[model samples]
Target: MSLISILTPEIKKAVTLLFDANIDTIEFQATRREFEGDITMVVFPLLKVIKGNPVELGNKIGTYLVENVTEVQAYNVVSGFLNIVISADYYLDFFNDVKADKQFGMVEPNPDDKAVMVEYSSPNTNKPLHLGHVRNNLLGYSVAEIIKASGKKVYKTQIINDRGIHICKSMLAWQKFGNGETPESAGLKGDKIVGNYYVKFDQAYKGEISELIATGLSEDDAKKQAPLILEAQQMLLDWEAGKPEVISLWKTMNQWVYDGFATTYENMGVDFDSYYYESNTYLLGKEVVQMGLEKGIFEKDPDGSVWIDLTEDGLDRKIVLRSDGTAVYMTQDIGTAIQRVKDFPDVGGMVYTVGNEQDYHFKVLFLILKKLGFDWSTNLFHLSYGMVDLPSGKMKSREGTVVDADDLMNEMMQTAQTISEDLGKLDGYSEDEKTTLYRTIGLGALKYYILKVDPKKRILFNPEESVDFAGNTGPFIQYTYARIQSIIRKADFDFASKTFSAGEITLHEKEKELIKVLALYPEVIQNAAVNHSPALIANYTYDLVKEYNSFYQTVPILGSDDENAKMFRVQLSKKVGETIASAFKLLGISVPNRM
Candidate 1:
């Protein structure tokens, strides 16, 4: 059991016995720095059941905890807070027990527990993934790992938007402008090769629209009447009708995009257990619409369109099926979601990692599902996140200004190389090792900077700022981890298997603080899983690294004259590095054994 678990009930018992009051929940927080304790109990909440002076109340409980709990060595009362100083022996015992644990603070999922499905990187095949998709993929992958660590089975998945008018636009451009150029002939990634055509289509579309407007047409009419766009629209219709030539072309182009996306996902270190293509699931929710109509969950308009009225539920009306009997995006989504449940019967919930622009859409979709009577709908969550902006501004794919995922990753590696060379940390390393370390540090900086912030808040990503080896950045923590590794390497003794017996030696203040921070790992992981936030895990890791650094600077490890103290500190350093690696793994980041 954890220290918090063992103390919660005891603290409650102390409160009950001393104040003669019943409390349902115990409020405990880390002791403030200015306070002389390791954990604190808030006395303000107890006033409702036991009215008394706040400071006096704190003193009474503080006295009770020291007398009754074996771990509690001392206590202090400040204002309405009772700070309890736990014995150093307790921390040493806890650390000793966990030092050799390879899977420390992580739990295994029980077979009986319902599995969770996380959906991310729902990219349209029209263009290669951009900066926004990086954040989405990283967030999804990390959250899935965290959920698994918290003792629930998790499945990672994505939906490919392979069929739409947008896709036809790219196809039309490639056909009209190209002399049948292929990704192989062009020596480009299939997605990037196809993505160039997407941009070409937009440029041609704008030129055609401008020409039509010059000939006395309104901008909206010009856009609608443009020959290229009309052809693309016809192509969508033909593709839906399964025209032989169009279907063949569609398959070829989508294959190129798929091959291209596979490379990107591999490089980004994200994966999916299953996938849903819009082409396969586009017609799915039509039958569901009929079910909704029969159950009165949806109403048929005079034009035969199906819609769910949610105005009374504080949302606007939303259409499920059009009057022409064609399914909308929402219909396809409904069908896709249902299909997933059928595919993975154990899945009890889903997390959709979508941008904040779709906030209203998901709200409507979740509500519609509840109205349609799906039991799993209750567990649905929309992990809405804000846009990732650059220092310059927002990105536009059609304008060819969006940051390509592959190119951005390469740029990060280059930047890392430059910075590392300047820092002169790669002495005596071979070229290949240097390359690997550069990519590791670069990607680490990128992932950590993005994941450390709250998902709902917009981020202004600066690669240079992120890679700096100080001030809560990824490379900063990575450097600290590497420093610990260097210390472990210098120690000739076996620190891995040999640690001091618990309570055998006295503890320094910094050592106690480090242990306290280490003890919070399991709780941090649990909280990160429950709230679906990688930011929690990211910041917790930063805090742990900071505490370890403080201990490293103030305390002597191998230089200690006392052999017991030297061995114990080296063992402590190894544990810190292990914990760092563990936390970084959950974020899809790797820590180098050497800098």
Candidate 2:
């Protein structure tokens, strides 16, 4: 059992000691920064049917909690709240227990007969991934890992946004302006090549629209009068017809983009069991529309466009199929889910790691799935995260300032390499080890930066606020791990000979706090999994590492004369490093032993 579960019985006894079994419900939460202990209770919330003032009630509860609880060192009555402090002895025992159990605080999954599908990093072929996509990818990857660690059978998948008029625009620009160029021929990344064409389409169309407006055309008239969109639409129609030349071109270009994406995904250290492409599923969307229409879940307008009426659910009706029988974005998602269920009938859940802007879209999608009698539809999750913005403003492609994922990764790795060299931490490492260390440090920095914030909160990307090597960043935690490894190497101590100490050592304040935090790692993962937030785990690791560092600074460990103290610190540091590394792994980051 996890530490939290083990403590529950003790907490219950404390509560039962103070009040009549029926008077108050014991509500204990792992405390927050504003609170005083590992567990805190607010008596004011319970005193609704009682007679005493909050502080008096708190004192009575506090007194009962301390006297009745074996693990509790003391309890304080602050205003209406009872803050229960765990004994240093008890806290140290808890930490030592955590350190001894070598699973690094991971618990076995509970019995649940449901499979989960987590979809993430659905990048469009028209452009490369950017900082926004990085946030989505990291959050999605972490959430899936956490859920899987919780004992759920998770199916990790990706849906490539490969088809649409947007893609057509790129193809059209490449066809009209270029004389048949390929990534190899141009010496450019495939995604960048495709993106350049997309940008060209916008620029060319903009110039045309502006000149038309100057020639007395209204704004709407200018856009409508322009033939670029229509040409793009025609390309889409041709694509749908399986035109040999257009199909070949699309396949070739998309393959390059796919290859480029695979490289990025590899560096990010996230993998999916399967992939679904829009080109393959757009037709599936059309079939779903027909099924919905036959079942009266949707209707066709005079123009023969199919739409679902969402008014009953307080949402606007959405068009599923156009008059020309083309599928919209939502239609394709519906098809993808249906195909996925058929492919894996045992799969009981699906998660869409999408931005919050499409909140309404997923809400409608889930509701529609339920209305269609898919019971597992209730298990569908939209892991909606907020957008990533630059400090200056929203990322604009027109300004040519969109941060390319590949370029950013290279820069981070190079920066990490330079930092490692300057720190003189790589003196004894081989060239290959140095390279691997750089990858670990670079990727760790990227992951930490992305996962440090709540997924639902907007983040401002700042190059100036890069991940610090000495502060609450990935490198900082990595350095701690490296230090522990260095010390372990020097000591040449066999881990197999380690023994548990009887009773608790009189630990310093930092040691007690660090132990308590370390003991809570399993619960931290469980909570992060349930809440779909990696930031919580990230923050917890940071706090634990910070405390460990403080302890290391205050106490000597390697050659200390006190055998018990030395062994205690060594064992504690090893476990802390292990736990921190495990946490980083959940976020798709790595820690290097050398640097």
Compare the candidates by TM-score and give the number of the best one: 1
For 1-595, candidate 2 gives per-residue lDDT tens digits of 4435545565456445555444435566665657667667666765665567888877776676577656666777777777777777676667655666767656565555778889999999988887778888888889999888767778889989898888888888899886888888999888888888888898998988999999999999999878897788888899988999989989988988898888888877888989988788877767778888899999999999998898888998889899988788788778889899999887988989999999998998998888777889988989988888876677766335688888878888888888778878777888888888888888788888878889888887654245568777888888888888877777666543555554535676767777777877877888888888899888998888888888888888787777667777787788888888888888888887776
Best-matching candidate per lDDT = 1
Please give the lDDT score at residue 64 for candidate 1. Answer: 79
| lDDT, model 2, position 79 | 79
Q: Cα deviation in Å at residue 403, candidate 2?
A: 1.6
User: Which stretches of candidate 1 lie above 4 Å from their native place?
Assistant: none
Candidate 1 clashes: the total is 0
Off by over 4 Å in 2: 1-18, 23-25, 29-38, 48-69, 109-112, 210-219, 225-229, 290-296, 299-303, 323-325, 398-400, 418-432, 494-496, 503-505
**Reference-based TM-score, model 2:** 0.90
